[model samples]
Target: MADRTSKKPPTTRKTSLYRLTDDGDPDLRSLIRPRYLDQEGFRARPVRQGPLRGLLVTGTTAPGPADWCQALADLTGLAVNEENHTAFGLLIVRTEKHIYALGHGMGHLMIEPARIDPGFGIHFAVRCLEKDRVTKVRRQIMDARGRSDENSVTSGEHIRGFGIEEFGEIVSHIAGKVRGIPLTYTGGDAAGAHITGNDRSVKLRLGRTPEDLMNDLLAIEEVCERDDPLPEFDFITQVRPLEAVSDLAQGLDARLDEMLGTGVPGRVGLAVPSECREGFDSAETFRVRVARRTRTVPELDAQTLLGPVSSCAPGERLETLRKGKVQMFADSDAEEVISGNVSAGRWLTAEVVEEGAHYFLWQGKWYEVGAEYLATVKRRVTELLARPSRITLPPWPKGEGEGPYNEKRVAARAGYVLLDKKNVHTARLHGGGWEVCDLLGPDGQLIHIKKAPSGTAPLNHLFAQARMCVETLKYDTGARRKFIAKLDEIAPGHPARDFREPTVVLGILLKEGEPVTADSLFSFAQISLLHTDNVLKGLGARLEVVSIGR
Candidate 1:
């Protein structure tokens, strides 16, 4: 009794796909969680023919109607009682090379975590696109000091662009810290392209039919096999090399264990991950706790939470403690509880080296720096060090004084005018008081000095101050005048009369035995300094970096 006139259902559907990078066929019976499979009317069967020949699964879960249905019915004075059921399906296509997962609704939750490839969608998107326009970009910039900023940008129309400059200047500058957790764009042919991040996976919208899905997978795999599509973004890469090299991966695990035993907050601290943005603004405060019985800590710092870990009882390992869940709870009626890996929350700044390869762990992920990229960064740093000191400043007194007094003493010894605490009011320029520089050289050199830091926060702050000063002086005539006026009052005969473009010297006072070299700085500090130097050069100012041993 089927009606021949009825048209066939649409062949296209929005599909969420994942590629299994591991070898061997996974046991399908054990794949889906038992709770989901135990639901009513769950069916799973094997397919032996056609393009979708693998495993097919379907399930249904009835959780009743949404809570808001009753509220909407009361307000509208109409009957709105309705039952709700979630219908999900999955098709696992096994090919000669690898396995592909096509999921619908909540099908992604069916598979266990071990079989999926991380960063697959991102790598695919970067490879297939041409040199044209990027409409959206999602990026996370972390300062290695536990603070990070995640931003998402979208365009209403396909815009013309290529590389990082496509996001414009300011965004490009901030993106200098890191690039492309996930990137979206419109290709040269003007097709809308996007790649979205999911829980431990990524999503791509593509044709759902078996044939089209197979073809797309092959094309994507071929493209990714080529060389890196974007090399200019090597400043902070997202790809994890440890995934492929088992030896290096093992070494990293051991390194993490040793560092956790030290329990030093400066070397490793904790924070709420930048990616977990749900209900963050509404939470008044966030407290972290490890074990069920351990009292919750007041803040997210490792010093406050872990203290000197040596004080722990025998047979207790911080590494084991790190595996415990970090509960971010707020004191409110909502009582929102968010949990993530304590190890992921820990901010690890030390570099890991194995077999001449370098890696950095920040906010839970490992970022590998290629040998060529490392060399280039070192060369830039060396060039900065080659610039002679503008003034013959003395070595800092061997751990004998604080920053402000030492700055004054150094300036006095070098015949430079100390501008410490000389806060200039340039509401029109920056909307608040900020120092132009710590020391104003008599010959027009702008000197900024800070003691080398155990953490990157102080160095990042120092860099930001120098950058703001350069930008404000370059653009604001009134602010420049105010600075000169303040300068005259501080040192009457100073030669910095008009405040034109001047040489900027960033001096770091190292500990007594630390030498002045490229390796003296942390990787993050070097990265920030390079970006600041580039910005300064673009504004027609020269930059010099020096390390003074105490």
Candidate 2:
């Protein structure tokens, strides 16, 4: 009857350093090397004012400016300025608690002269509430070791969380705890209730507690409400034994053979041979009855008896069969039969039976046909046969020091595989520019012949176009094949030259055998060179590899 739930303790913090100079070694000059004093081609310059500062809120009814500053204090221990405000943008809020810090424009924007500004510092923060009712229950369970009574305590806590809507789950859980007989709840408009069992019925009140009802239900576990008894025979000695005998006599093989013989007649007669006659003479003779065949009597036909056989040919005749006034026969063969009626005066080379049925003799066998159904089957078969096999190229190797041997591989390996070509192979060129090469298969088939372009395009557009091409190739196998094949078709008069010249052939080029340089790999992968240049410069690679004409 007591309140069982408890609260969780507050979290603790870890150690931190205020400043690097606070260490015992105060010679900060040792951390500064001679290279730090040397002025490189480009130097890091701090902005006059750092990143922008702003307060992001859900709505006007959102927690006041003080709440925003307070949350910031709790999160970073830093004071936030909330007095001055700027324009706000309306964002589509998809959920109850999901709200984003918008309009900062840090990463997803083009940096131009108009976009650049000083004294802009964006300080974004989030505030969330922590609830701990269930957390306290978990902590208590962890602390209480090897205790059965603790389980009941937790179960009571769980029941408190259950509302009226969860009545079924709560009843099932309580029933499981008591190991009581299953009970189903039923009620009508008059506030009535009943508990039904196999042999007895009990009228029950709707307002009793689950625990009390569970106790009563278990006490009458054997009692049931109704007895709609099943018809009984001597099951063990009579019914079951007879069924076992039937199953043994009609084993799977005999039953399957009986099913197969349903519509078919046996070709051979059953007779005792001379060798087996001696054994059969001593054995019990179960009288075997042979199936009788119906007699076939010849009927006289007017044409067969009065005229020559050729006048009323014995073989099927080719005739144009018609339904109503429409002539349906398309071609003729004497053995083909159209079994249906034909319009008089219509030419018929094959006999037509009905609109949906016809018979044709091919290779000495008669084949029945359904016109529309046959056409549908032919179409589906054609489509299945025409579907092109999807071919997936193996993933390009990752990391450095892999793939075919090359002497000038130190810089990087940049190449493209002509995936749709009959023979797929990677083409890698050092330095830069388009080069013609014969890509042959093992059997010497010219799978792909390509002439790639040289020179670099603007940094921003290079990666975007490469990604577009890769995505386009993923869905359009024909277009991918055409693009690869176009490489071979590049002539002086071709229109591709204009577009090809302005674009940078960006790709990772590995030395024939050595590990590809990080700079070259970035280029090959078509990552934004401008954005990654700062990072790559730190790794001892030239930020700018070569000028277009140089």
Candidate 3:
């Protein structure tokens, strides 16, 4: 590929140059963000050793060396030698607004570091295997292309510098996508493997390879542990579908409305603005969709960075914003649901962590919940604690721009209708830091819930949330007004007036399929069950493990 622009940057300079140069090039910033000290006003200065060394953030208020060094240590979780100036070969220093990093071979984070365009670099990928099967394949490819020297030193277990070739009869079913690029790497070195291609040259490599390129395609796709024929319940217990509980609530709500006729109130409903209230039809009152930035899910914005809800989308059920499985519903209504039950159609993360799991070794703490499911549960619990509105997944899918895909690159790509919920919102008392509970229940009862298999961490997290909800309600009596107001809006006719209070019945929907009780997940998570009962009893709320299987 030819270098198009003639404007060349100055060499042997400070970090400021990279920032200035990067502003005109968004791609440069993207490449630098993951590896270097960016945006924080880094300046380049000469160092005693290494190529064009010395990097630092510039500004009076910039964080200092202690902070940057600590950040580096935290990032890698490795100790650093401040005096030696060598850890990751990095001499990291930070002032008020300036931070500097310079290491041997140029650590790829500098503004216009050296000898690299790094344009998403070549997607070189090679797998490390104990065998040399790729050698014959590479030999065949070289012969076909009339090339030689298959064992070239520069092509050390890398995806680049190799012609795309057939993956052999064992894996010949694959299709090639990158035009004019081979899809296989048959290196001679059985001791090493890699999948790397530099962006410096498109002639070398381009586009993505199949994800499981090295997954011993010779074997059956599933050689072990397929879903048991007895039931999906055990697996469901291990991986609780977070959406399933909401679905049950919604399903129950829908069933109740249908059974009781016209205006008969149900346990679930949404509280949107009176004007937007019409969107919540009698049948659709079990509003499942909420804002993308709702409290239950992870908040993406920096200001709203209460916690992380990093999505592993296109997940088990093929649920992802990309797959159109996530629900980003259209709401020209509110920022979040003021008070309501989450519905079935809404997008929610699936719970994969069994109850009472721990990571005391990695976390270095006693009884820490260590599963992705629990992490998600914590966020959802936060949402429930906030008493949000019903949220839809695939939030109003916009074109390829603001939404899943935008092959055409439309004008409103990534566009979303920000309903004016900020205007008609209600008071949601924020609780202190807490973990996720599985259940998201009505406002009047014990709020926030989670399902835990046989473990103490999840149960602890659940109990803590139940305790917090009790405390919040006890402290914030006026919180009930918001709850009452939501009931008035959704239930109508003041039917909730007959409802009781203080004894909010928070349900932890168990994976206990009917006719099976003793071996239920709740039993496994019973390590802290009695303690949880004692806590909730003392705090003044009810906790019930209500199982509704699929």
Candidate 4:
């Protein structure tokens, strides 16, 4: 027995991070860990399902059937058994809208002559065991063996006795029953499978799908499911023309054989007749004609023509045959003649020569012609002429200063200046407002200056004077002592950083051929001069050293 007490009012609400299924079971965990969850305290929620579709089809053929069985297996993945002459397999047919399949298998049977009434040689029974819809069926037959069977062979006498009309009727009856059935021809009786004809060939027929077949068959289970139902048809029914069907079946069989071989059909080549050749005088033209059939001149027959000749130059003359003999003359000199003739369409020979205004006696008559006429005759004789010569130019000059005048120095001398301090003097020169000079220090180290100078100062001369001062002061004890005392009193900081009132910077140019010393105090004094130069150069100002005192 338990005692009950009044419940207290709820103070807060609770929220859940874990999710449960519709049946209240905890949701399952993921098989893989998520990258963001590597920190160890993360979880994933449930996802929803979407739509899906698929399909399948299965079929089988009779045992001992070669061509059709092999073709079906290759194209549709159906399996076949020789002993059964039957096949059983499936097709997984898929499309965007849905997934489905069809499964089927069948056995074959031979009909007795009595039952196959019209007496067709042999009759085969085919049945559709399962399908989504009625399928199209095609049939064909060939000699399973290369020759007729001895056991089933009929004598010509028996065939004649049966009568042509009777035999025709038997064939008709057999064809009618096989019309919609899927059939194949093989060597031997129903037991042994030998493909007939060349490589045991036969015609292939397309089968109608179950949907288009008899309505009863269309009610079979969906393509994706397995369902069985038997549909029967007579084996002696009349079929359409077999010759056309046979041709198609044979083609399909051939394609199958090709596919089985190298997985691709072999290619065949075609033949093309060679073209007629054309002739020309130049070997270049002849070679071209051989490779590419191009005739430069239509009238120049390959059998009779020769060269491409040219006429005389301007103001040239040649002899004119006005009446078959050298009759008239014309100005200038004549050039060469290019002419040729053909013989028997086989060989071509040509000649070239120069023609002038005057010629020796021919047939006892001296002939004279104007230069112009000779030139014209020369032009007519030569079928073509070489191009004119080109003009030559003089060579270029080799050494510097041998060409144009250079004003680079004029631009360099724009600014100049001179400075003096405590009887010490210096000078500077500017080009393009830039300093260019060689500087020296007290310790004998030469310093080179090459930069834009400040304002109007002669930067080069100023540098030279500063260098001379350093060197001159180095050997004079009294002067050095005084300079050192002045430097010690002056701060070595930049102008902007110097807090001392009346700070004066001395701008000096070290002279050429002077020396520089490694003494720290002396170096400092020289550095101060360099700093002063930099400040003046940056500000575009000019400066002069006034004095050096103790």
Candidate 5:
């Protein structure tokens, strides 16, 4: 009799593979959705013969009208409502020490999002033999400063030329927090792998047939067994979604509450997580509700946030308030709930470098900063501290605001011209309205003063303000002329009349208990200041950071 279990011949067809996380539930039945199993033509059974020899789920999506059917109907003047079906399959392969899933067509939809390991593919890609020869790479890096609500992507031929060292330099920049989303590399005896950010799985373009898929799986398992060849890529590591509920998260939450409850101006705030979806752009205000009460606020701040959080019953934990959502509306009363939580921690700027564990919260997600990166941040802060300032101004009085202090009081005491609110308009600059500085000294010192904020947002704003003014004066002739004219108006025969390159002083007024240390300032704030320092220096102007108040 012929052998019942006959091996199928391998064919050249592409396939994608996902490794189930060790901590995730291994039962394939639990991971798959019931609706997918019930789909027409769906089949779930054990593979009788193959290298994988595990449970296989094969099916086609229920026939649906093709997306271009209506368009085709109009063009052809005939009934063109053609039905389309997507063939998909998932094979659960179990090895001695690992459980893996192979997705064919739309087979990825068969597994639960939470179960697949997010870093498995990237690990294999980095360790693969052809790691040096990369064809295409997709990277995501967020603006360290909160100036933008978008994550930028990088790709193309230029990426193809980059080696491991070049990739290191790109991610090491302080301006943004970068991550490799998906990287494709080829060369070295066989077809290469396409490592993707989607569950961090590897896609093999050459293994399309079931027999070929088993070969690819075996190759992947063998590659995964090796150690990572490039460790320099760990400048910024991802914090797993499940890990967010750990003790570190609890500490972060408590710190956020402390900052909000203390009523620090910039400690906690709100922002659009992403670009408003068309209609929401006109939203000028927000209605925040936590617990039973609601209040309207111009912008989210610590004081505004504290009210709603404090309104909860005495025994309620802050986590309970997360159920309440924030609403945004335009001119009409049609309010849309914008946020799923009111814990304030979701919007808080929490950066902690404790006991060698460095964590930064950016856009509501946590990232672990590598030791080398932490050292880089410390060096920046240290250099800024050691730089001497050419000008100094007294601190704001106990109950006075920064604007009032600069315009009303600091001018008389420091013998500096009050240039606060002296807006110089130029079409080329950032939004046009620009101030030379808060105060200008007789000796040509450009003094920019700001209250030392607990978070990076306000500090970054201050840094940008100073950087833009200097940049304007250096480049925009029209803006410089307008600034000089405004200066003469404020103080006749002012030293700025000869404003070639004045010393730019950044004066930060510290809170009573806050110290002037590297650890005291948020890491992103230091990065902003360093960036400002570099720009001002390039413009032939000296930059200095001074803590106001002895």
Candidate 6:
């Protein structure tokens, strides 16, 4: 269980920590924008249940497969038939300001807006003025691929003639020789553009959380207001028509294949020369160089750049130092302290990166070789912090989004009465909110629980929420009075915990399993504790961190 009483960022202190989830909506679920998957079959379609379509489907339930069934029906006002080729739908994403959806080059917002069918293709070619005198761009690609004419330069709907991974570099190489077009927008006749590139090799979809979408629009609006007070971009974020989703998908596929390599799915093999300029001949050093040897080395450790991809084959493995002879088995190999002793020619299925050396993913964690060679490892005391392995990420709830909900219920059943929903006050940040103490006991016990699906509570965010809630209550006089009155009615003469008095809350979320994780929570807890002492001390409150099990 991870619990913290950390201080908030400086900005959180000055303004209201809680914003209404919407302009005036009480239900907070409206803030979620789910990710869409691209599995084959019905799941591949961008609409029906996909965020890729850009339709803001309104529903309370975390949008799941079944839930999407009803949402689609509601959106179309007609039956949804995946089998119906003629059955079509369009989904668009837009914020309140862009309710009318206008702006400069709003077309870029959507992956594509035209011909929402499978036949669409993204032609990833340099869009150039015929007079740029750089027809060599196409000619060069054709010559390299041993092609004759422009038609021969492309494959099917894609320009398979050129290396997809080199697209960015190619554009840069010819940037000066060609002019870039402004993608056609009013007040911005952005024309005379150089090479244009879009790929339709793989069905790709882009997703943005509502918060992210809001941030982008807010940033755009801020710039516009500073210059053009009556900015037309207020309508910028609204989803508009462009190309087809299929084209974007293809482009995405072609690009990923280029990066991940067609070798053996997830596993990549590198050969190191026994000779080096410097005397540094360690396998770890050599491996690092190869990974960085590519122009994409800056983005090494592939997973970060790969995005959501197929997991490596089960038991998949990669050997950064495989089939290579070694000087001798040492207590520590390279800069890493080995578990025991590894012999020469023994490939390291699990290795880590360190100070120009591989040292156990920085102390404790370890990543396995194979397809997952590039996975980041977050471990504490040799125990791996788990990632969400669920097929779908559950919808983040609107309330506190904390475990204290379950904790409160368990305690309530165990005889500690908690505040009812109406009496439960929250300080909401329109995006999310947190609850102070779910239930205060007659014994002056204030409880705040954190929910952790992986059995490790996330302390930082929870602490921020808890701090915001308590501070909001403390500063908001009417709210503070109302809470006290409610407490008086709920626990008459029970020595209720008072906001103006030194108070105590049992943070009963952490449970010491067979392997204790409290130490893992140490860093965050220290910061949170310092914050509570400095900030919450005036509120006459302090939280006691403890753990309990079901």
State which candidate, 2 or 4, has the greater TM-score: 2
Model 3: lDDT to the true structure:
0.27
Across residues 1-550, which tens digit of lDDT does each residue of candidate 5 receive?
8775785654444557778744545455665678877776888887656555567898877467988999988998999877888888898877657778878888988876656775565556554423343444434333233332212234322222432122111222111111231212222424333443322466655454455555556666666676543454343233222135445555765655454444343434332332222223345566766656777764444445455665454434246345555555563453554433334434445555568776666556555556666577678678877787656566567778878888776788645888887888897755557777888876878888877544554465567667767787877888888888887777776655655676888788665635466766766565556656666777788877777773
lDDT per residue for candidate 2 within 396-478, as digits (tens), equals: 23342212211123112223322231222222212222222122122211111111111111222232333333333344454
Candidate ordering by TM-score (highest first): 1, 5, 6, 3, 2, 4
| Residue-wise C-alpha lDDT for candidate 4, range 177-250, written one tens digit per residue | 12222122111123211111111111122123322221211211121122311222221122112221233323
Candidate 5 C-alpha error for residue 20, in Å: 2.1
Clashes of each: 0, 46, 82, 112, 3, 44
Cα lDDT of model 5 overall?
Answer: 0.58
Candidate 1 has a TM-score of 0.71
Residue pairs clashing, model 1: none
Q: Please give the lDDT score at residue 137 for candidate 5.
A: 46
Better of 1 and 6 by TM-score: 1
lDDT (10s digit) by residue, model 1, range 1-550:
8897897864445567777654443666565567666767888788775575678788888788878789989999997877788878887777667777788888877775556665565555544433233444444344322332334334322212322321101111111111222212212223444544332344554555667566666655675576775543323233332342234444665675566556663444333344333323234444444433344543344454455343554344445455544545555432566544344235334566768887765555556666666677678777877887666556666645545544656766645877777778886644666678888776788888776535443465567667777888988887888888887787777767755677888877654536546776666566667767776877788888767665
Error of 2 at 203 (Å): 59
All candidates: TM-score: 0.71, 0.15, 0.23, 0.11, 0.71, 0.27
Local distance difference test values of all predictions, in order: 0.57, 0.22, 0.27, 0.22, 0.58, 0.30
Best candidate, lDDT-wise?
A: 5
Q: How many residue pairs clash in model 5?
A: 3
> What TM-score does structure 4 among the candidates reach?
0.11
Give stretches of model 3 more than 4 Å off. Answer: 1-46, 49-319, 322-347, 350-512, 515-519, 522-535, 540-550
Q: Mind sharing the TM-score for model 5? A: 0.71
